[model samples]
Every structure is written in C-alpha cells, then in structure tokens.
Target: MSLLLDGVTVGYRGRPVFEGLTLPPVPAGSLVSVVGPNAVGKSTLLRSIAGLLPVAGRVELTGESLTAMPRPERVRRLGYLPQTLPQAVPLVAYETVFSACRSALGSWTNADTEAAIEAVFDRLGIRHLALRRLSEMSGGQRQMVGLAQVLVRRTPLLLLDEPTSALDLRWQLNVLSAVREAADAQGAIALVASHDLNLALRFCDQLLVLTPSGRIAMGAPEVILTPELLASAYGIEARIERCSRGHPIVLADQALSTG
Candidate 1:
C-alpha cells in the first residue's frame, strides 16, 4: 500500500475535525473515493496525505513517514491538485504544461519537457489548445490545464480535491476517466474527494465516507452508504438500488421530515 493513515487526527487552527480516523491500508493501483457533505473534513484528510496539513496521527506513504521527508521530496513523490488552482501568468498553454515538468524531470532541458507536455496534451485531448493563453480558455479547459500539472509532475500518489467541480458534463466524464487511466497506467494510488456519489459509484473501487461534521464511516460504499447511515448523516432517507452490474444507484428518499 502506498497510502496509510494510522489513527490520524486532523483539524484546522486547533479545532479538531476528525479524531482517531483509521482505515486499513489500501492496495496500490486502486482508486479510493472520499464522499461526504460539506465541512466533513474530506479535504482535510486529503491535504494531510498531501503533506500540506499537519496530522496528529501517523501518515505513511510507501512505508515512509510523511513528517520525515522534506517538502520538495514529498511533493516529488506525490501530486496534489487542490480545488482552486492559481491562474497561469499569461503563459501559452504548452509553456504552462512544460513548467510543471520541472519538478518531475528536473531543470535540465525544456526539450524533454516540451515533448512530455505535448504528449500529455495529446493524451488528454487538449493538443489543439497548446498555443492558446490560459486566460482565453473556458472554465473546463482551465481545469484540464490545472490537472495537466499533476500529470506532468508524474508522481506516484495523486490527491485530487473535487477534481470535476469546475468542469461541465463532458469534461467531467473525460477528467474522471483520465484520472483512473493515469493512476492505473502508472500503478499509482489515487484518492479523490467528490460530491457526486453517482460518479464515484461509476468510477471508484473503494470508498471512505465522512460524516456531515467530519468523522469516519470508513468502509466500501456498499457497506457505508446504507439508509441508516444516510438518515443519520444527511437527515434524509436513502435507497440503494442495484443494477445488473451490482453497483448501487442511490436515490434520496424525499420523506425527509415534517410530521
């Protein structure tokens, strides 16, 4: 397993969000989805794995303690795509992609960087926009470029925060498929925080659901996304139906409250 959180407790500014958050180590080359209502500390758990947030409990990647590694080294080993990516400085699309490779391939040559950048663009279906400026692209294109960074970085562990939040429907499907392909193709572990339960059900193999206020309901989606769990966490009735594939299609039972 490349990712392990052993009794990890996380918070922001001394306010604990989740305590004693523990899960069995996940096997590599699998996609793990984190789903919960807002403010549930899903992002907090991801940030901790990315080493951007402090963890009260142990966090290990590839059997190495996150605290034991320096920032650059850890970043080199892990790719983090936060929800809000900074605006590119009017750089051409290809240039921006090339810049991301500096961390992975080093500062030697922009030649190799340029080649890999184009390859990523081709693989991601964005090669046509290579000459365009960052400010000119639509929201979804910008999101794709932001995602291209983590791809060009080519790290073994990817932590994505609501990766499809800014994308439209087609782009959303493309981006999620790309995420799965990238992770499995390279044998890297990926953890994604998503609000779209249906999308997660379609794409991910495992799940770690959080409470509305932030605590672990740690298990597979089938085990954790029951009517009882949904009633308690979201105060709504939930029906989990199985299609022919055995994957659950969740429907919110609208009889929420009001006697």
Candidate 2:
C-alpha cells in the first residue's frame, strides 16, 4: 500500500504555487508529517492530494488513481481534516459523529454505528463529552470531535491539515497518539501538515520539509530536521538534541538576522 504523487503541480487560478512536485511513495501504516513556514504551500499540498484542488499530476493509492476516482468513492478512500474547525452546530457530539459516519459510507446498522461512535470517542478520550452539544463544547473539545469524524471513516488515506493547532499540551499528544495508532492498527496511510516541529519529529515516521524556495526534503525526522535546513526553511537557528528518554528534540536557539 503506497501513496504516489508523480509530478504534481498545484496553484490558485492561473498562478502556480508548486510545480513538478514529487514525493517518494510511502508504505502502508506510515505517518508522514509535512513541515515548513507559513504560506509555503504545505496546506496546498494536502488539499491537492485530498482531491479538493485541481492539480496536474498523478495521485495513486495502492496503484489506483485517486484523482480520477468518483467523488463518493474518493470520499470513502480519503479522509481530510482541515485547519479550521467547523462552526458550532445544534447537535450533540454523538449526533455529529453519527452524521459524519452516515455521510461517509451511506448506510449502516444502528448497532454497528453506535458501537463505532463509542469506540472512536473512547479512543480519543472524549466519551465523556459525547452527550454535550457542540455549541457548548470548548474549541479543543470541538477539534477532537472533528477528529473523531475523520478517523471514524477509516479511509485508506488520511490527510490532516494542522489537526493539533487548537489543542492543549495533553490533547496535542493524545491526538497524535490516536493518529499513530489508527495508522498502525488499521493499515492506513496518514499524512499530516503541522507547524509544530517537535510533535512532528516525535510522532511522525517520515518528515517532508517544504522550503521557502519551493524545494522539498523528504526522509526520516533525524535526517531531515537539520540546523541548516531549519535556518533555510524557517529562518531560525535550531539545535537537534535527544531527551532523557532518547527521543529527538528540536530546540530553537534564536532567529537568524535576515537581510
């Protein structure tokens, strides 16, 4: 199970944001994080692969073309969570999640649906809020609920854009852990777009760094998260170190003086 992007180009209107972009095929059950500075087309890349944007390239999953698939079929195969959370609806968390599940697969037995929703809420540690209304939940809570909607789909390809932007420290770690577990246990491909370098380095199996020059660096976190690359892509002086647990950590020392 490999996700392929061959010579993909995407942009707004007639302007090209990224051109001739190609990423190495990632195997099944891998979590890949896309990291870079603001407005560097990180989100655009995910949107393109999610089939939300028109692009000139081939996006394939398991040797099948995702770009040419039908919309309903594509929805069942690809799950995308955008950066912005949805506006508060009048329904409870359970209802919201149920609606998402219904939309994803069209039809299901009532028992199966209820069990699936409960399982997802339990995995996300949000089962306590299952009865709460979305209008009453906090931003972070709503974000987790939104995640439940996506993960419940159990798609082959998962594209998340800034999934942890609204969460606190604990939830941030929780969300990534759930994503990692989903990929590992379900044999899915998870691609995340994140601004947090530390979380990406800690949880993601592979890192793709989108540079300011529109170039990309793809490899393991330790190999890609270098001082030179950080300085070039983010304009910050950073040091790579290992914590007491032996996990890699990126420490930003200072900002480089840009002329």
- What lDDT score goes with residue 152 in model 2? 86
The clash number for model 1 is 0
Tens digits of per-residue lDDT for model 2, 1-259: 9999999989998889888888899999999999999999989999999899998988999998888999988999989999889668879999998999888877677787888888999999999989999999888889999999999878889999999999999999999999999999999999999999999988999999998887789999998788999998999999999999998999999999988
Q: How much lDDT does each candidate structure score?
A: 0.80, 0.91
Deviation (Å) of 248 in candidate 2: 0.6
**Stretches of model 2 off by over 4 angstroms after superposition:** none
Most TM-score-accurate candidate: 2
User: What lDDT tens digits, residue by residue, belong to model 1 across residues 113-226?
Assistant: 777787778878888888889888877788788888888776788899988998788878888898899778888888999988888877887888887745467667777778
> What's the true lDDT of residue 11 in model 1?
87
Candidates' RMSD to native: 2.2, 0.9
